[model samples]
Target: MTEIYFNLLGNSRESYRKNLILKFLEEKAGSGTGELSSKYIYYVETTATGKKIYLLRPANLNKGMDFTVHLKDVQFRLIGPFKDRPTHSEIIQDLILKKEENNLEYEKVKPLINKLFLCQAVSDEEYRNLHFSKGIEIEGILKIIKWLFIEQDITYWNFSGRKMLYESLRINNLV
Candidate 1:
C-alpha cells in the first residue's frame, strides 16, 4: 500500500521541492534499479520485502496566482506471490482510472500527460493527430497547453520529461 501527497504551494514556486526529495531517494538508492532521471522514470524495488514503488511530480505557477491541488493516495497489496508483481502498465492504468473519474479536469492531469509524453505512451505525432481530430474540443487544447508549460517545468534540470515520469513511480509506505 502507498500513500501519496501533492502539496501545492502558492502558484508553483515550490515545484523544485518535489525534485529535491526524488533526487535524495535516487542517490541513496544507488544506480539503475529504476531511475527517475531527467529523461526516464524512476522505479524502486525493495530486495527483502520485494515491494515496488513509482512516483511523478508536475508543478505549475503563475507568478502571483494562488491555486490548490488534490493530494493522492494509493495502496497496493500482494495478491498472490511477490514474483507476480503488477506490471508498470497495469499500475499506471489503475492509477489513471481509479476513483478520480473526473480526472480529465483535475490539475494533475496535465502533469500526467507530460509524463506520458516522456514515456512515449503518446507521441508528438499522436498528439497532433488527436488535436486535429474532429471530435476534439477547444477545452482540450487549453488543457494540453496547461500541461506543456507548467508540467514540464523540470526541463531546466536537463532531466527532460522522463525524470518526472520516473518520479511518478512510487509505493507510498507512509500511508
Candidate 2:
C-alpha cells in the first residue's frame, strides 16, 4: 500500500510541474519584446533558469532557422512579435486604460505640440491642423506623433519625431 500511495502522489506532482512550465512558456511567448531591423527580426528568450538568450533570423524569410545572437540588450523595442503591429490609436488607448491618470487632454497636449512646432521638430502644417478640427482629433494627432517618435522609425515622416516626443514626455510626465 505504501508503493501505491507513492505512485499516486508522484504522478500528481509530475502533472503539476508540467502545467506550471507550460503556463510560463505561454506567458513568455505571448508578450516577449521583438525587433524588426532591415535584415533580421530579433527576439529574446529566457530559459526556465532565468538566463536570457538573444535570437535572430531573416526578417522576410520564413524557412530560415533561428540563429542565436549574443547581446547585452537590444535598445530597440517593438510592441510584440512582428506578426502584429498595433495601431497608434490602440497604443494610446492602451496607455490611457493602463493608468487613468494619463493627462492626454487637448488642452494639456496642445502646449507640447506648440512647443514642438516652435522648436521645429514638427512642420507648420503638421503642427496646426484644420481650424475646424475637434479637440479629440488634435489630441490623437499628437499622440500618433509621439508613438511614431517612440518607435524611432522615420518611414512615416522625413524628420525624426524623437525630440518632440521626449520634450512632450518630460512636460506631460504621462504614466
Candidate 3:
C-alpha cells in the first residue's frame, strides 16, 4: 500500500519536502531517519522490532512508470509509488481532457507541461533550477525538451537546448 500526501506551501519561498517527511515519520508515527538525494532515497519505518528502511529508486522501464505529480498552488510533486502501476497515463489523459475543455492553465499544469516535476532537485529552494536527471531517462529528457519547444514555443535558440542537454548528460556521465 502507498499513501501520498500533498503539502501546498502558502509561501513559495519556503519548502520543506525532506524535513516534512522526516517530521511526519518521527512525530506522527515514530522516530526514524530518511535519506533524500538525487540518486537514491530511503525512509525508515519504525515498529516494535525497530526500524525498517524502504528504499526508493528510479524505474528503468520502457513504459507505465509511475510519475504521478501533485499540482497545487505553485508546487509540483510526485506522491508515492504504487505496486507497479503509475499515474502517468492517467495524468496525461487528464491534461488532454483539460486542454480540450480550455481549462489547461499553463501555471497550474506547468509541472507536467515543462516536465520540471520529472527532475529531482539538488538544492534547498522551492524551485530547484538544477534538475537531477532529465526525465526518467537521459534520452527521454531531450524528447521532453523537444516537446516543450512545441508546447511552450521556445523561439530563441535552435541548438541551445540540445547543447545544454548534452552538457548535463556529460556532467552526469550518462552519455
Tens-place lDDT digits, model 2, residues 1-175: 0010011011232342343233323322223234422233333323222323332332233422222232223221355643133334444443444234334443354465445333334433543442322222332334344324423322212364345445544454432
lDDT of 3: 0.29
Worst 10-residue lDDT window for candidate 3 reads 63-72
* Over 4 Å off, model 3: 1-10, 27-86, 103-175
Candidates by lDDT, descending order: 2, 1, 3
Instruction: Give the top-scoring candidate (lDDT).
Output: 2
lDDT at position 2, candidate 3: 32
Candidate 3, residues 20-120, lDDT tens digits: the string is 33433532221333333122233322212222223232323311111211111211135643421223343343334443444333234344323332332
State each model's CA lDDT, in order.
0.32, 0.34, 0.29
Candidate 1 C-alpha lDDT tens digits along 1-175: 1234332222341453354344534432333323532222233212112222333322122211111111112122336433222333443444444314443343334554554443323333433332221221322332223233334453433454434433544331100
Clash pairs, model 2 backbone:
none
Candidate 1 residue spans exceeding 4 A from truth: 1-7, 12-31, 34-140, 157-175
